[model samples]
Target: MSIIIITGGSRGIGASAAKQCAAKGMGIILTYNSHPAGAESVVRQINAVGGKAVALALDVTKVRSFAAFRDDVAKALKSTWGKDHIDGLVNNAGYGNFNAIEAVSEAEFDGLLNVHLKGPFFLTQALLPLMAAGGHIINMTSATTRVATPGAAPYAAFKGGLEVLTRYMAKEFGPRKIRANAISPGAIRTDMTSKAFDQSPEFVTLLAGQTALGKIGEADDVGRVIASLLSEDNGWVNAQTIEVGGGYNI
Candidate 1:
């Protein structure tokens, strides 16, 4: 069976992607940092549907842990799916910290940098050996990178770097038949952003007004896209940033 790893697969886009990919017959090895319950719930949902899935702990901010995490992934692949390599990886683990640039501290800046850009780079490097031929790598970026939203300067800048790094991953890993792409999601309703939407109905309405679709996206909106990109049907799609934001700020 084809196997894939999704970081931050406990909730939101990653969790939805794990379920969708499993439904398509891909074995899943999903990672979570603190939300073990959410991760296990996702695994159970996949297994309930007769799909194979497993969850592991991963803190994306710690680059030092990737090697060990890779080891854990290898064990999961062998034990769960009897596979030695993974066909895909979705670097979907991240958090949101909205702070103006002038008020953003160095610690906050470094934290965002570590998770959004630096961690994906190193984690992919650590896991590259176990990636099979024709494997795909996905980097979850943001529409904030393009829209210049005020309190998200550091986050947007880091996601922008990740988008660029996606292109380079495609360029460098192309010879190995591994494709790379970025999914820039606009205002999406996930646990991460749900509180904001709940806090301000006006904020949600304003964002919806700016979007061409007249609505913010759900986790499924982006999840299905991630699964589709992992499929053989979209092998020709590479090194491209496909925004799934309902055409926000257009």
Candidate 2:
């Protein structure tokens, strides 16, 4: 069976992606930062359905720890799937921050940069050795990169950088027959945005109005796409940034 590692799989889109990928008969090694319970819950759910999954702790922002994290992944592969290499990776761990550029603090900007850009770069580099030939890498980005959302300047900037990095990864890893692509989601209702949706109904309505489909997305909307891309169904798709928004800002 194909084995895949998804970071930030404890909750939100990452959690959904883990379940979806498992449903497709892939062995999952999902990582969580601060939420081991959430990750374990996902693993249990997958196991309950006769799918195999394992949860490990990972803090993506800590580039220094990626080597150790890679070791843990190697161990997981061996113990859980009896495999030495992973078929795919999903760089999906991140947090949301909303602040105007003029008011954004240096710490805030650096935090976003570390998690969204630096983390993916080094983590991918660290895990490259364990990636099997013909493997795929999926970077989870955001539609804010395309739409220029006002309060998401730093976040969008880093995600845009990740999109560019995706192309570069495809170019560099082509010799290994590895594919790289990005999923750009728009206004997905996850734990990350639940507070905004609850506290400000107008915010939700405004986003819905901006979308051609007249509604924001659910986690499954993007999760299923990620699973399909990881599968052989999208073997020819590479170096692309697929916007999973329902035609927002078009």
Model 1 over residues 96-212: C-alpha lDDT tens digits? 999988999999999999999999999999999999989999999999988989999999999999999999999999999999999999999999999999999999999999999
Question: Candidate 2's residue-wise lDDT over 18-122, tens digit each?
Answer: 999999999999999899999999999999999999999988888889999999999888898888999999999999998998999999999999999999999
Q: Of the candidates shown, which would achieve the greatest lDDT relative to the real structure?
A: 2
Compared with the true structure, the alpha-carbon lDDT of candidate 1 equals 0.95
> What C-alpha lDDT do the candidate models reach, one value each?
0.95, 0.95
Q: How do all models score by TM-score?
A: 0.99, 0.99
